[model samples]
Target: MDIVLASKRRRFVWSVAAAITAVAAGDVLFYQRGAYGGQTGFALAALLLLAIACRPAIWRDRRAWVAAAAAFAFALQMVRDPGPLPWTLYWVAAGMTVLLPATGTFDDGWRWFQRLLAHALRSVVAPVLDLVRWRRVRRARSQWRFNLSDGLRGVALPIIGSGVILLLFVAANPVLAQWVDRLAGPGLWELDAVRIMIWIVLLVAAWSLLHPRPIQPIMGTFDGSGELPLPGVTVASVRRSLIAFNLLFAVQNGLDIAYLSGSVPMPAGITLADYAHRGAYPLIATALLAALFVLVTLRPGSHTAAIPAIRRLVGLWIGQNLILVASSMLRTIDYVEAYSLTGLRLAALAWMALVGCGLVFILWRLRGGRSASWLINANLAAAGLVVSSFALTDSAAFVASWNARHAADVGGRGAALDLCYLRMLGDSSLPALIELEQRPDIAPALRDRVRYVRNAVLFTLDRRMHDGGWTWHGERRLAAARAEFPDLPARLPMPAGDRMCDGRLKPPPAPPAPESSPLTVAARP
Candidate 1:
């Protein structure tokens, strides 16, 4: 019993130590430096810190290794483009982060994710409880104990030595220096409440990662199959619905094919742009509803699923829905080409593709007799994959550049340039606007408008840098723009009132001339 007590006490001490170490590592990677501050090298370094502090046996677990790989993927994506999607996936995959000590035993990803969430909620008060437990552990007498001398020599000395070594390494290595900007966030004596609060948050997050545990409420299962649950969804009714859904979808696809190929003339009032624009989003909605209908009616374990005839019909319907999704995406593309690409349109394209992937997964589930959990996981994984790809892309910059190339003002034959819209896109649009302003073919009037809007954007960006505190991506973009700018003007006052970045499709009417008076006599040019 004494040995067992000693073992428990020792483990608790290690857990506490590990939590502290994790917190320190988090401070290095995240803290106040901003998202992806350390980038890839620092991210890996932070992971290494967690590995050393976490239980040694976790290293032997395949799940733990898989979790580490996921961490790397998320961190790299953050490095590529720091945004909410990568951050969401980072925490989503973090369910298995280092095979968290108190995540309890789990066989699958879904359970791990559920446990992580349960544990995280409980961990809100974990710090206070852990402190209370520490008091109890301190009073309990044990034969095997860690004394002050032992702690000083064994723990503190090593930490002090390692910190020194780390500092030296950081000085010698640029990557390390970039990753470990120790004490560089705020001044050593600075009292920033926000930064301090961020530190506390990081500590809680790290500690929770190490010692997560809570009642993992009974997870709901996807075994919700059977005719009993979905009333009136009989095999015969399902057959009729599948055939009808397929026919309706076919009609949509057929019309799309005609418009897409220019093989048929419009019936009447619909212009190609209007036809493309109107159908893009609504068709996507139709596909989603069709998917939900399939899930509810065609349970793999149901009587309908047992029949090969029903399966073929359902398969045919899903195939048509996939085609419909493709048509929707093409419609969005056609609309964009006719008008101009915007951030929202780019997102619409990605969202449509994700919907198509969901339809495919639903069909696969029916064919394979996969469980509800399996289907959900497959769709989630697809979404995560798409989101990560998006995180790596610069949608705003892409839209700006695409519009710049295709705008008829500069020589291309697409849509007329809308500098107002480009200005609305913010700093990311600066380079593209600079390109337009420099073009000789660009109208003199348009060039002057671009210069005015461009100068205002530069002023805002420059002011942000001057305001200080480790601005990175923004600063780099501003520098690049400055290098490209022709005879860069001094920082200008930002536009006030409703300028619309100097008007929409066409320039606004020139302000009315003031009446000439003795004191307001017109001056000769």
Candidate 2:
């Protein structure tokens, strides 16, 4: 008993020591470069040696001896080339990362390979161990272990896929390292983005496995008004959902990165490395928090019982719409300058205000014991507003702004309106634009715009154009006008005649004559 107690105490101390050292080593690897390799090597070697020293036959048994030898080899590789080690050595290190366990075990030397190997072992070996253990227990119960096929069907494939990905990621790290090094040449910000992407992928994969479903209270009310014993969510389903959500998040993040890469590049002046480091912790933390939140919210009864779930869904919708708004805003700018008012701006503002007010209303209603139907109707209205913001805002502003801005040069506001009308018809109205150049009443801007659009369509569709022909009702009038002014060029100035200016579309009325009547008014007075 004394010997056993001593063994337990020693094991506890070693485990604590290994963990502390591993953490310190990881920090050094992240922040420092000089002797970082040596530091990591020493940390890993110390843990391995301590594990072996605590064992009785580790020195005697060949497999235990081999593990120790591998640990020694890792230390040697670390010392030999401290700058940048071989790919194989990194693989060896990665293997060690997974083989080691997190908690109580003499095999802590193998913890180095923990991340890569656990999923595989969980996939392939775990079921076998479970089966054997179940058989041992089942004989007494006179019933077979929980359906073998169900166990295999549910857990087996996911574990294998996860393990495969983890290992592939580790193995691909050397390739990733090369890319990182190349990016590092551009400075740290770009490099940092790359690192952030790497860590996010890893984190999303790892934590998604922890809990995939929502977890709700058995007692809904704070005062225990609706307390009831009930079975809650399963861990496996939650894990799967978390994985799917993370994957979706990663794809969106990748799109963001692609978009930013074209414009932001190095984020003002920060080095890619520093930039990457700065964001790494926060992004990982947020993703983990989100995963936890999603898991809890998604748990089968959690949405029904919890108010927070409703708020979360609303918040997510708001965020998604905001992103859509920003994208639409960018696209709108190609049609006009920023200061000019596009109908989209009004539509977007209206949508935002309505949604914001509705959200506030829901919060208020939630507190006031309103029926679920009220809340549902409110949410549905908000969703409709979101869709309307897109459809009503995109093309209407495009055509109206296009007409207003080019009104002076196109053919006054009238010709500009004609172009707007043509645009509304999409590709089918190309002949109208071609015919617009002949109209004597058409503003030069409108005439030029029509011709340019006509040519663009012809080029795009590879169609032949005749010198003079009636296009259609409006098209025939414009074609005749263009023929009368053959000197007109393809480009037209902004038509000055349109009533549209800045944001407003309606034309102002003519001002009353004042000076000419002043003398007559004076005589009457």
Q: On a 0 to 100 scale, what is the lDDT of residue 230 in model 1?
A: 62
Candidate 1 segments whose C-alpha is farther than 4 A from its true place: 1-48, 76-81, 100-113, 137-196, 214-217, 224-229, 411-415, 466-472, 485-525
Per-candidate TM-scores read 0.76, 0.23
lDDT of 2: 0.42
Candidate 1 lDDT for residue 148: 40
lDDT of all predictions: 0.71, 0.42
Per-residue CA lDDT of candidate 2, range 1-525, in tens?
Answer: 657644644544454444444444433343333223235445445545544554443455555454456546645444432223322343343233323222233322223234344443343334344346545544554343344456569999999999788657746798765675574432333335645544343233222221111122122212211223336543444445445654565565555455434454665665434443344334434433553343233332343335454444534533433343333333333222322334454454444454444545444453454543454455555754464334322344244545444554443422224444444443344434544455577656545566655544433322212222112222332344346657645443333344332212355778986776534545565
**Which candidate comes out best when scored by TM-score?**
1
Instruction: Provide the lDDT at 228 for model 2.
Output: 37
The per-residue C-alpha lDDT of model 2 at residue 186 equals 28
Error of 1 at 310 (Å): 1.3
Query: Which runs in model 2 stand beyond 4 Å of their true positions?
Result: 1-247, 250-254, 257-370, 376-398, 403-420, 423-525
Candidate 1 lDDT, tens digit per residue, 42-143?
A: 454364446435556566676666766776676665554455766666665564654453455554446656666777676777887887876666556544
Range of the 10 consecutive residues with the lowest summed lDDT in candidate 2: 208-217
